[model samples]
Target chain A: MKIAETDPFSFKEMRKALFFLTFALMVLGTWMTFFYAPTEVVMGHVQRIFYFHMGTVWAATVAFTVVFVASIYYLVKETAKWDTLAYCSAEIGMLLLTLTIITGSIWAKPVWGTWWTWDPQLTTTFILWVLYAVYLLLRSGAGGRGKKARYSAIFAIVAFVDLPVVYISARIKRGISPVVFGPGGGGIDPAMMQTLLVVLLGFTLLFILLLRERIRIMNMETALYTRGR
Target chain B: MKAKLKFIVPLVIIAFLISWLVFAGVRDSMVYYITVEELLEDVPDVYGQKVRVSGTVVHGSIKNELDESLQFTMADGKEKIDVEYDGVIPDIFTDGVEAVVEGSISTDNIFVADLLLAKCPTKYESDEARYQRKKG
Candidate 1:
């Protein structure tokens, strides 16, 4: 549970700095999206939704990739820190995944002319959301820490397996979902791509900040529980 | 260490097998998009292949063949393909609307689509622009 040799004030200052940076970067990303990024010839201003939509998915991918690796390490090493890291990442990944689905759906209404479809990409993403949500529920709505951690670690691995499938679902078989990368590459403009990369970097910072804060809280709670026991 | 090794070996093998099966299954079922040009280049070659062809609906080429069946010409500037569909046409389906039809070309060179999807016009104009257009 010992996070640093530095004093409590230093930790507080670091958190404040991260919070300010994350907020400032997010605002800057938004400004660039609306003004700097040219309106897409095909989708127009509505295409602006693409920045946040893809950004959240990129960040969620980072978080879940960590969950997959950490869960395996936890199983082998039986370390509490690995399990905590997996759980924290899964929580943040799930929140961002929800945002991805919601924003994608909003953009879909004007672009695809439908609010939702059972397209492979959409379906696989939904399944992932359910899987991670169950991971969280199993952790809290069940037995002791040992049992819950073991169960959730296995669940995290199973859930991570779906990530690749969700990514390639649009390319697989006859589906209406657009492909951002592949043979055709969807013909994205260079300016739009630049904005997307900027937003993605901003969201990545936000993800790291959120994961650190969540893990600190979890470690404190674990410390309290062990002391009480 | 011996017991841990025993547990680890089977887990790795099982994971490998499962991933292989998933990748193979997904590859077999993968449906990809193609342009009108691509579809025409190999009508016989692509015939019966489960495929999606996207293009703009040719202006005035739409003909309501019956209660459910409709015929239209889909063009992507370079080429055009005849598409026949018997499904609930999307509200956005109209002349010049961008569309992607999911099905395959028949031996007769008609794109028999089971699902017809009309891409909506990108909503980008500001309120002022829209109002000026409307007023004009």
Candidate 2:
């Protein structure tokens, strides 16, 4: 299967489609964040950051998942294309997740008294951030493809272990366990749940388009480099 | 797939368990922001509870009492908030810079601050003063 589009007809169409999806989701997410959700009966307008925070986080999670799956595929298939996808997604995921964490910190400053908490999700993500950063650093400095892919794959396998922990903690806290800091603790209000679902779906669609574009650009660069050689 | 799952499944399960608690902590007792009027309306119901209050520092309201506790009133719109902070205040803590106080209200109508943060003045204030001069 083609890793990226080459057809003239599909190229323009896909670009247009991706662009529209990204902007539409951004606009809808912005609007709902500003006007739809109640102004947090206490925090006033600043609370709107929650929607943006969640949207970016939703996109980052999906991108990281792609990175994980692509790492596995590249290892098994020995295809550079899979490697390229993993690299691109990892980079973009880094950018988006970094933005998400920063914005979340800013939002927390106004409400949570401090810029950060050693809460599980935040702590786990910080660990994941450092782990992936080292993975990329190794990829750039590593000597050979065989070793590079192997080490990165092993790192990916270990790094992503945090994902399940994050997911399970959120779920267990809300559903069965009466824990203090659980996800959707006691579940979300109906309106918040609906709004969040819309935002999550929209962000996921936008992320897919972004991943496609990144992969396309990455493939083009690879082709150009090979031709030059 | 099987080999991969062997490592992934157990790790995922443990993370899932911890994450549930994380979600609860973040979602359950999220701190709230309010003005003085709102906090008073709720009284001792909010005593010893966590909250954030935003308002202006009343020019003459500050009193650094004998016990080294600082007390001041903050106003937002039609409401004025009174706060007692024992800790050292932020550097910018002065008259009329919009500030946010964190912590809880005491039963005695004093907003006991655990932390205090003041907003930096926007550069546009000089521009507004210039415009007023041109008009007046």
Cα lDDT computed for each candidate against the true fold: 0.81, 0.68
Quote the positional error of residue B63 for candidate 2 in Å: 13
lDDT string for model 1 (B31-90, tens) is: 446799988887677879988788999999999964758999999999998999987776
Q: Can you tell me the DockQ of model 1?
A: 0.19
- Regions of candidate 2 where Cα sits further than 4 Å from its true position: A1-9, A168-184, B1-136
Q: Tell me the DockQ of each model, to 2 decimals.
A: 0.19, 0.04
- Tell me the TM-score of each prediction against the true structure: 0.75, 0.60
Model 1 agreement with the true structure over A175-200: per-residue lDDT tens digits: 66766655854455566667777898
**TM-score of the second chain in candidate 1:** 0.69
Q: Which regions in candidate 1 have their CA more than 4 angstroms from the true location?
A: A1-9, B29-56, B59-71, B75-98, B101-116, B119-136
Q: A1-229 in candidate 2: lDDT tens per residue?
A: 3644555457777779778877887788667766665544334466567667777877888888988888778766767887878878888778778878898788666544457654455665786688778877877884766778766765765576666555554343211111222443333334555567778878888777878888888789768978999
Superposed by TM-score, candidate 1 places the C-alpha of residue A171 at a distance from the truth, in angstroms, of 3.1
The DockQ of predicted model 2 stands at 0.04
